[model samples]
Target: MESMLIEKSIQGDVASFEQLIVKYNRYVYNIAFRMMGNEEDAKDMSQEALIKAFKAIGQFKREANFSTWLYRITINVCKDEMRKRKEHVLSYDVENQDEGSMKENIKDESTNPILIYEQLELKETIETALNKLSEDSKAVVVLKDLLGYSYEEIGTILDIPVGTVRSRLNRSRSALKSILQVQLAEQ
Candidate 1:
């Protein structure tokens, strides 16, 4: 069914493309949000990536994984925007997130106001640290840690070797630990 949609999409069928969008929109938006670190930019980048995907559907090989192809496009779009801005100080707009989004990850602790506060604080700190990372390192961390993609999968998405992925993830993790330690100590 997905292959059919892809074929039709490649043939310039807007409805078929919309069907594919419906299936992958959340995934694309989630990656965009993580990379952009804000809702507004995420939405904009996600839309831009989807538009690019629609335009390049013919170049998509049938043997390749659709999600991976889409992810590469999304990441490239976000990275291009990041490059243009040349600003790493991203603000994670937690208050603006929908109830069903990343906010849901901390919902289990909501019953305890203290835990909720602590969770939010930690989340913000982590997001801040993540935003400080280089685009390459952050992409590795977001894909492997936050998005739960395997090492091989991340390499495929980022067009890097598995060893490179492992090394970047290691360095990114160390950097995040150091940043978190300093942040926690300051509080």
Candidate 2:
């Protein structure tokens, strides 16, 4: 079914392409959100990536998975957006905003309240720590850990060697673990 959509979309069928986008929209947005750490930027990047993919459809080879191809486009869009944002250097109130949300989520919980609170807190801590990582590191972490792409699949999506993917993923995980451990200690 996906292969047929890819074939039809590549043949200049606009509706086919639109259908593909609608089908994978959540997946694309999630990748964007994970990479950018914000909803607005993620939406923008996802749209930008889709536009590029539409234009470049002719160049896509059927040998690889369509989702992998889309992943590459999304990652490139995120890299470009990050580059532009680096020039602005705006500081976000990540800590305070997350803490309030964490409290609210934990407060209304009824079952396994302690464990649920700890889990929510940990998720926020990881998100905060992830935001601190460089864009490249964040992409690797998002694709490997959050998205659960296999090592080979991630390597294909990111256009890196499997060994390189493994190394970067290990480094990203190590960095996050260290940062979260420090945050937990401070609490």
Candidate 3:
């Protein structure tokens, strides 16, 4: 099926191209969402990536994974969108931030008012610190620590060397640790 689509798309078959988009829309959107931390930006970046993919279908080489290539485009699109909106207004844009934070997720719900209240402020602080990271670092951090992407796959998707992917992940982890340490010390 993939071979047929590749051949037909290379032959200028728009329907085949559309089929490819349908086949991979979820994947592109997932990558976008993880990188952008929101549904609206994810949807927009995913659509733009699909359009760019269609326009450049002729140049797509089959040796590498097509999904990975599309993932690269979607991530890049998310990064570009983030760059345009460099201000830290995501705190107010709940739709753009991840639904709640780690502390929120771990809040006890079994009628433990004390426990729930204790974690609420900490959760807000952690979420704000995460929002302060650069888009590139955030992408690497989420992909490796949250989504568990290997260095090779991340490098492939980001069009960078594996060493760079590893470096980025290390740097992101260190930055997050420092941010958390400071927050914890203040508490």
Candidate 4:
């Protein structure tokens, strides 16, 4: 089914391309939001990625799943935007704003609101720590840890070696621990 969409899209069928965008827009936006750390930038990056994908659809070799291809494009769009901004773009406040939804799974009435607050604080701190990482390290952390991609898949998505992905993940994790430890000490 995806292959059909890709084929039709590559053949310059605007409707087919639009359908592909509709299918993947949210997925792309999510990745963008995580990478950019804000909704507005994520939306912008998602649209840019879709435009790039539409233009470059003919060059897609069918060697990867369409979603994977979209991911690569989205990642590149994020990295490019990051380069242009030359600053940390993640907005920890977004997480705080979504707390109501995040707490929906905590059905236990006995759960402490104070504990939840602490957890949210910790989560925001960790997100801030993530922003401290270099873009490459951040990307590895997002893909491997946040998005649950395997080391090999992360390497494929980022066009790096598996060893590189492992090293980046390790370094990023170590950095995160150090940052969190410092934050905890300050509290």
Using lDDT, give the best candidate's number: 1
Candidate 3 residue lDDT tens string, 90-168: 4322224343463354343344332434567766665556655667777777667766778998898888899999887
* lDDT at 50, model 1: 99
Stretches off by above 4 angstroms in model 1 are 87-117
Candidate 3 pairs with clashing backbones: none
State TM-scores per candidate: 0.82, 0.80, 0.69, 0.78
lDDT, candidates in the order shown: 0.81, 0.79, 0.71, 0.75
What digit string (tens of lDDT, one per residue) describes model 1 on residues 35-95? 8888999999999999999999999988889999999999999999998997544433222
Backbone clashes under 3 angstroms, per model: 0, 0, 0, 2
Question: Candidate 2: which pairs clash?
Answer: none
lDDT-based ranking: 1, 2, 4, 3
- 37-140 in candidate 2: lDDT tens per residue? 88998899999999899889889898988889998999989988888889663333233234454545544645433243478788888888788777777888
* Selected candidate, larger lDDT, 1 vs 2: 1
User: What's the distance in Å from true for residue 57, model 1?
Assistant: 0.7
Which candidate gets the maximum TM-score versus the true structure?
1
